[model samples]
Target: MKHIKFSISLLLLLVFASCEKELDLQPQQSIGIDAATATPENINGILLAAYDIGRNTSPDNLAPLYNGNYSGYLNISSELLGNTDQVSWNGTFDYLRDIFNKALINNNTGALNIYSDSYAIMGHVNTVLANLDKFDDAAERDRVEGEAKFLRGIVYFDMVRFFGQQYNPAGNNSQLGVPIILTPPDVSIRIERNTVEEVYTQVISDLTDAFAKLPDDNGARADKYAAQAILARVYLQQGNYTGARDAADNILQNSGHSLTATFAEAFDTDDNPSETIYSWVITQQEGTNISNTHYATEALGGRGGDIAITQAYLDKFDSDADQRRNFTYPGEGVSTGLLLTSKHVRQFANATPVRIAEMHLIRAECNFRLNSSVGLAPLDEINALRARSSAPALGALTLDLILNERELELAFEGFTLHDYKRTQRNIGTLSWDDNKLVFPIPQSARDRNPLLEQNPGYN
Candidate 1:
């Protein structure tokens, strides 16, 4: 149960230094840049540092902000936005209110943190990519490179979804996207935003290359199938159903992964079920539990109910017989009348980033979209997941039915907003094309980098 500690002090020192010639290292903190590339172990440590940053979900850290909370896994209070009757949020935090209201300013702390944190991780990855030649073994070099790129690709994918307009195929994906920092930026260079298409192209290229270079077995780290699984998600987000289905199918058939026997098993604290493709492993000594953000009540070891499930969302589960329904309970503390979920309960539970069940759903939805051309019958795929939950299966599939299934099955895992936007589905009173759907580029970033332009309507 002892956690492995990976230090990034040296890497951060090197990465944040204003000038290359000013890269001075404290004797006890980290190795010099020359010493880092001098050995395979040193370079490998930097790769581990990237993983450490990726795993950070610390509520206090400005960098690598919590994706789940921001993505609507937990409902926080909002003062700027009128109170919603469905879920109670303790909106004392101004930054969270900015997110809830979709009224993000360029200087909002949460927005700035995500933007800064993503690039911080990317900088580390780029450093690893830059020094791949220094790795003594060719295969080791490829493995490291693949893992780093996989991390980079997912980071870019997340950043683009948050900061840019939804990819519109009709418009040729011409909307402004996040600035792509491929190699670490020079101190004097301010990067400009890439078009949405350009960012996607790089994301796909990174993941595709990662899929090729990664080993079949990477344990908790990313592997070949993890790259493919994420690529499926990217394809789905872009409305490329065929590509999504094929990528997902590859994982379902070839990877030795399968759905856990029951719906509850997927979120079990004792072990990571076979369903997980890639996860952020947590231990007693390291990483805070996500439950702290979602569950209310001191009994549940959560803060005063920062987020609660809306009755509207809860009503999506039409069948009380569905085993997944057991995850919910009457809310307490600040969420006294609402409902909360036990999906993330234990302080040491692992956070699943991708799982096989999602792959099947992706395949099913894609097959449905494509009229059942490439993969299994869409009904069968739907039934497979339904069967796990003991929910009755439907004979035919419809877009609404599929989305409802997604809402129930993937609730609180940070998919709702993206799912609604990508499918052009309206959420509550907001239309798909509403300017508020896309966040403004944080003002701090624009102030620091002149080439960075804000998203429309936020100025």
Candidate 2:
């Protein structure tokens, strides 16, 4: 039943993603920001389509062979870039290898895909926001609008992290970030990059509005708690420990979500465990888990094996105690000793973007940092997940214990690069804020929009 809502059918929507402001004509796919051209049905389609676009799960995307921006590399690009040889990128895609090696050029296809695809999702949300008035009922309109903002905020949050400099809490983060485009592309579309601080301010604003306007349960779609969950993440990212703890406390105290019966049970999106605060759905009929294709081997219903596990990762935890390691296995027929992860290997496995498990960690870390226990004691919160996995409980808690717990729990779930940057952990020789750690602005974007500027290292 977990698949009932989003499994309806795949949508073929032309989501426009462009940087050109001075255009001879309005783009053909432009959803003119006018309700006269949009109906209730059309608005609904656009909103639903935005979800698919984020995951790039549906067919008929700009490119069909590989995963589109978010779905394919949502986890890969980030993890690979911060991998530090801990995980192997055996995939044939050179663009990904470029990202991992930090040898990215301005036109690196990997960076371009993520940059453009994120904005494409923004285009969908902008279109939806423009047509909320199409619904006659005021409350319904608010719900639809909240959902749009939820998705738009999500895209912006991701875009700024991948393309712009990391958010700074102590000083003014005036560094250039991605453009904050709120309107759908029409006759005029020139926009400049917003500061990292500005982009985050907008993200928080949008998500705060989403939290206020979104309903408690919108099927498998984003609900009120989903917005709050992302807000908790946003605060955690910005090092607002108080806000992160309070926000996480709100969900933990009232959201009725908890860890699954076991650690592994939380991963099966098909079960739709309450632990999953938000997830990107994948169905054979609706679309595929291309993210899985890159991570799993051919035997586990993925491509020949783009990503494999290294023995180094195994050494991170007590292999005998940590149940999470049990999922790793050697490649079916390869003598090269390549190992695959079952997390994304299973056909049509859903991508988990946020979950209650993360919330427990956030609350724990924030409480530890703030010296206040809002929901549970720091050790209690930490042990909740550890105890679930049967991992040995710590006699006490420290910052390193909390961080290692996060690493153990969120490993290979797309937290690598951002976690490193946030915690100021160096990726080997590269400092946490190294220029190479940042992705360059795609040259194609600069070609179309002269106003945009590149990041530090690309110079």
Best by lDDT: 2
Give the CA lDDT, 0 to 100, for residue 438 in model 2: 82
lDDT (10s digit) by residue, model 1, range 313-405: 667787889987667777665667757766755556765447788898899899988887465788888988998999988888898898878
| Residues 1-459 of candidate 2: C-alpha lDDT, one tens digit per residue | 145434212222433433331221234454444532257877777777667666665444344422455565767878888887678877678888888887888878877777766766676678778767789988888899899999888878888888877789896899988888888655457678899999999999999999999988777688889999989989999999999999999998888887888877777465467788877776666556666777776766676667787877877785467787676667765414787776776667666557788899999999999899787999988877888888877779989879888877888888889988999999878988888878888887787777788887686
Query: Model 1 reaches what TM-score against the true structure?
Result: 0.88
Reference-based TM-score, model 2: 0.92
- Local error of candidate 2 at 216, Å? 0.9
Where does model 2 exceed 4 Å of error? 1-26, 29-36, 58-67, 334-336
User: Deviation in angstroms for 227 in model 2?
Assistant: 1.1
